[model samples]
Target: MFYRIPSLGGLSPFVSLLSLALLAHNIDAASSGVINYGGDVPIGSKLVQVHVIYRHGDRNPKSPYPKSHYHDLKSWPGGWGELTDTGILQQIKLGILLKALYGPQNYGLLPEEFNVKIYKSVTTDVDRTIMSLIANQAGLWRSLKGKGIHEPDVQWNPTPFRVIADNKYDTIFGQNCSKAEKLVDMFRDERFEQLKNENLQLFQYAQENSGYEIMTHPTQICWLYDTLTVELLRKGIIPEWANALYPEPLESFLMEYLKAGSLTEEMRRLTGGPLLKTIITAMKNLTMGKDTIKMYAYSAHETSIYDVLAALCSPPKKPPGYTATLLFELFQYQNSFFLRILYRPGPDQTAFPMKIPGCGEQYICSLKKFEEITQHVLPKDLVAECTV
Candidate 1:
């Protein structure tokens, strides 16, 4: 017999163990409890454009604890925080997926030849994300080549990606937002304190098992869990103390804490404003027949995805895994445009249609209704709100 549990934060309607088991068996299986937007567009429908924002693929842990036993940087060929070969392959696969979905035969959204004006991509200055963009492009255009190019060994062409300057108020990373920091601090003290108190035993257990000191703060817990997760993924080593700690509860709490810390309505407006503005502007331009770019892609981080989800009022149950992707598809049907949102947890997984709250049974949301629902959440003046 299978049981269902309501997910926290209305992220998902239900969580089923059978679904999870199937997911484990085949990561590409359709996700359980997700509302699919159907595989093919209606007969009269045409895909007008697409905008995708995705997290970078797997990499070594960002930093190691000072007193931890996992201190050998040389052990990781990519060194600390660098993208690995595995990461590159994962992104390549994603690129192939995109090609299949948007390439000439599918939606005819992207041209065969590389055109700066036709397809545009941007990434943060960070190495992993920048490299991910390149890798993704390699996969995206693997089958297509430059005009009159006969180089036997050349299977790929250069694709341009703009690098956002790493300034204090950078939108992609949501860094150096004093307002966001203050908001997070206040929420931690007021709203999260009780949750922490209730989970004291779980936290204590983690502290005892984890080599690094585990703190009650959600961010700290998230960091610790991330570290543990990386270790398990890279090396088949689960810490000895993990056996007694009941790690699943700790993991669930960490996810809950992360959602609370970052997904708050106030936080979304402040941190996710620029991205929302970008998306909305693109969609509006498309509706007005003024949008030149056919496809837009942003290579970003988990925080970016989380904030975007929150702004849309459909926060995920937990953090997005490596190579997690959120796609915004605009379709033209009988002179009207509709939007479809899709989320894939990882590269090997099938994307699930995300139901925009209040959109009702039909997953397709009309442009006007989409704008009305999201208007309040998009930032009016990003700079002023992010000002220290």
Candidate 2:
């Protein structure tokens, strides 16, 4: 966690001093330390650039399910409906926080300024996601108004943020399977059938058990065939060897197989489940698009976040909000673009490394250094923070 001198006055001096000492010791472990984000910004201005992936504010379920497995949206104290009164209040307060932090002039935004050019795209899910997008933006709109920016020309266009329900979702293992799948297909010719036959045992069970989902077992299959086989050849799981092989197909899933233990651990580490690349693609599109976009917001489930990180082959550290919102600032610097991550603690409103159920607010993880497109993959030393 990035340790900070207390900005509030509630703590006693002695407590503060002790906290400071402990923070100094732990800061290096959690994060190297906040980068002085001065030089890296556009034109070297320390102006803030924000990208937020927020959950919809408090709201009722879209509809009552006759036999639902998830939590009841109606049971949320508010009627079976849109954002509750409290939710609107929550979003409005967030607006206040935004103006306070980013400052109105930073983005040339305004309070009473609801008309800012904010480009927004949301997943085409049910009401919660769509409502959350509307409500969260409303919060910012209200907040922007306080800063003199009135109701902005908010656009809620549908994007490919949602999973494309097809054979691919039910199939495909590891990340970058689009590339991996191509690699696998190269061996389909008759000349490689002999080699394919050698590996047929690996897929034999799936073919026999037609009901079995090979895609569901992508990591396991990759683990047994790829990582494990490679480790067996080396006779040990050394870090250097692991790193070299991780770029190969199915390696990401293989690593997970080696780490699995408790279900809780699975949930904790499985922040980005499957659809990682889609999120990255959407983010990239937003930045490159011509919308004069001030803020780009994503309202998705926890799995969406996890999958995006995985797809990016990003360091595996996940965001911290319950319905965490991760803000990424896409800045064009001297013909290059740099991304900065701002994590918001959520549904509860906190920042990273602070402990909240299903949230890790203790530290902020950024690829600010690795976020450069040229250095998409991380160096060895930074491996611990991410799965990639």
The C-alpha RMSD in Å for every predicted model, in order, reads 9.4, 16.7
Q: Candidate 1, overall lDDT? A: 0.69
Task: Kindly report which residue pairs in candidate 1 clash with one another.
Answer: none
TM-score of each: 0.83, 0.41
lDDT of each candidate versus the true structure:
0.69, 0.37
Q: What lDDT is obtained when candidate 2 is compared to the true structure?
A: 0.37
In candidate 1, position 109 carries an lDDT of 87
Candidate topping lDDT: 1
**What tens digits encode model 1's per-residue C-alpha lDDT throughout 66-160?**
44468679767778888876676667667766765777755678876667777889898789999888878776755333453335434455677
